[model samples]
Structures are given as structure tokens and as C-alpha cells.
Target: MMTFWYIFVMAGVTYLIRMIPFSFFTKRIKSVMLRSFLYYIPYAVLAAMTIPAIFYSTGHFLTALGGTIVALVLAYFRLPLIVVALAASGSAFLLSFFV
Candidate 1:
């Protein structure tokens, strides 16, 4: 069927797209900036993923906002990542339960 062919072609294209980057990069030399960027990319990605969730959970702005501030401070103080996450999530949960 046409659908089967379409799926096959799409799968091939997706695999090639995913593989090409590894193939290209594995053969190349790395630069200092690239190393630094790679090191910070996870933090940047974590912030990008978490920040919006902190501000907009359950349609309640203030509770989430307050928790976010607390989490930021905990993180700034160099608390463990798990502790920071737990503090933020626990604060948000308590606030939601009470307010």
C-alpha cells in the first residue's frame, strides 16, 4: 500500500538524519568552544525544560512562581541537584495542597 511505502521512506530518512551527525562528528577534531558548549549544554537544556514548567503548572501562577524562586536560590547555593529538584517540587506540591 501507499502508506507502507511512505512509512518505509520516512523511516529511512529519519535514520539517515540521526546517523549523519554521528558519522560526521566522529571523524572531525573538536575545538575548545565546542567542548565548553557541550559541557554547558545539559544545564542549558535542563533550565529550558524546567523553567517554564515552574511558572505555569496547573494554571496556578503564584504557587509555582514561589517554588521556582526557592529552587533557584537552592541551586545558586550549590545544593545537590536532587535536593534542589525535591525542594522545588515539594514546595509546589505543598502550596497547591494548601492554597
Candidate 2:
């Protein structure tokens, strides 16, 4: 079936992606710029993947924006995770009623 071939190709690609970096980058990277870039890659990737989901999660833009703002403020203040989450959800729910 086509699905089987697709799966096989996907697995091979995934394996090659993982294998290439390990096989090719065996030596220590001496470039400071490259190291810094690599260090921030995870955070950059996380934001890239997460920001769109956050904005689109709620059906309404205002509700999602309200929730995101609350979350950001609470997170900036270093509030507990549960508190931030609940407050964001509550704010979004309240905004949904208004907007």
C-alpha cells in the first residue's frame, strides 16, 4: 500500500536526520557564533511551534489574546504554573462572554 511506503520513507528520513548530525559533528564545534545559535535553537523552535497554536487555540482572537496576555504577565511574575494556567483560562473564558 502507499501508506506502507510512506511510513517506510518517513522512518528512513527520520533516522537519517538523527544519524547525520551525530556522524558529521563528532568534532567539538569551535565557533562561538555557531555554538550560541545551536544553544538557542530549542527555544526558537519552541516559540515557533507554540505561538501559532496559542493564537489559534480559541475560536475568537480577543479571547486568545486575553488569555495569552494573562499568561505572559503571570509567567513574568514567576507565578506557579497552576496559578498562571488557571488565571489565563479564567481570563479567556471571561473575555469570551464579553467578546
Candidate 3:
């Protein structure tokens, strides 16, 4: 069926995109700028994806805002990531009850 072909093509494309960098980039990157850019790409991508969702993921804006603040404070103190995530969600859950 057409749907099967579409999915097959998509999977192949996705696999190749992920595989090409590993096959070609066997040497260590020598450019400091390029290495720095690569190092921060994941964080930048995560922030871009997460920040907008943070504001809109809850029923009320204040609850989400409370969670964001909790997350920021936890991150500032360099707490474990799981602790920060759970505390943020807990703050949002508790705030939602009162909002």
C-alpha cells in the first residue's frame, strides 16, 4: 500500500541522516568554534523546543510559570536533573490546585 511505502521511505531517510555524520566524521574536530557550536547544539535545541511548551502545557499560565521558576532555581543550584524535573512538575501540580 501507499502508506507502507511512505513509512519505509521515511525510515530510510531518517536512518541515513543519522548515520552519515558517523561514517564521514571519523577525525576529531580541530576547530574550536565548530567544537563549541556542536557542544551547545543539543542544549539550544532543547531550550527552543521546551520553552514554548512550558508556557502552554498547563491549563493555567500561573501554574506553568511557577514550574518554570522552580526549574530555574533548581538548575541554578546545580541540583540533579531528576530532582529539578520532579520538583518543577510537583510545583506545577500543587500550583494548579490553587490557581
- Candidate 2 local lDDT, 1-99, one digit each (tens): 999999999999999999999899889889999999999999999899878899888889889999999999999999999999999889999999898
Q: For model 2, how big is the CA root-mean-square deviation?
A: 3.0
TM-score of each: 0.59, 0.66, 0.80
* lDDT assessment of candidate 1: 0.85
TM-score, model 1 to reference: 0.59
Q: What lDDT does each candidate get? A: 0.85, 0.93, 0.94
- lDDT string, candidate 3, 1-99, tens digits: 999999999999999999999798899989999999999999999999998888887878899999999999999999999999999999999999898
User: Where in model 3 is the C-alpha error above 4 Å?
Assistant: none
User: Which candidate model has the greater TM-score, 2 or 3?
Assistant: 3
- Tell me how far the alpha carbon of residue 94 in candidate 1 is from the true structure, in angstroms, after superposition: 1.2
Question: How would the candidate models be sorted by lDDT, starting from the highest?
Answer: 3, 2, 1
Candidate 1: Cα lDDT at 90 = 83
Clashes of 2: 0
Give one digit per residue, the lDDT tens place, for model 1 in 43-65: 99988997777588746897788
**Which structure is stronger by lDDT: 2 or 3?**
3
User: What's the true lDDT of residue 26 in model 2?
Assistant: 89
- Which one is best on lDDT? 3
